[model samples]
Target: MAYSHVSKKNGVAYYLHARVTPTANGTRTMYFFAKEVKAGDDVTKALDEVPAGYIVVESDATGLPLLKKG
Candidate 1:
């Protein structure tokens, strides 16, 4: 199952996703949250667990989920 976080302010659920992009130096992975999982999404893939040394946080103003280092 995909890792999900519910916002305390809005009660909206967000699923964690990881996106990989190629750079000049090398490839980098970025973590993000979305409401729904996209079909045929090659660049972004849903994460089953939170990455090590990271935690999820929600915005107080918008209730959007964010990844923070822990």
Candidate 2:
């Protein structure tokens, strides 16, 4: 899972921070989690199941943008 912040300037663009790990398939893999802005400005305490073999491209989920870049 990963955490990111929303752009204070744009308010729509997202800045993603993902976790990267090496895979045996000869390709690098990355992953992240999605959460809403809650408890004031903290990310949600819970996360949903992200699809396997795919990174989170974009999540206009709530306020924060959950994006995955590899």
What TM-score would each prediction reach against the true structure? 0.91, 0.26
Clashes per candidate, residues 3 or more apart or on different chains: 0, 0
Candidate 2, residues 1-70, lDDT tens digits: the string is 3234444434653333334355787645343443342232232232334444445443344444444433
TM-score of model 2 relative to the true fold? 0.26
State in Å the error of residue 57, model 2: 8.1
- lDDT accuracy of residue 25 in candidate 2: 70
Q: Candidate 1: count the clashes.
A: 0
Give the alpha-carbon lDDT of every model.
0.90, 0.40
Q: Lowest summed-lDDT stretch of 10 residues in model 1?
A: 36-45
Put down candidate 1 lDDT per residue, 36-57, tens digits, no spaces: 8655387889999999999888
Which 10-residue window of candidate 2 scores lowest in summed lDDT?
A: 37-46
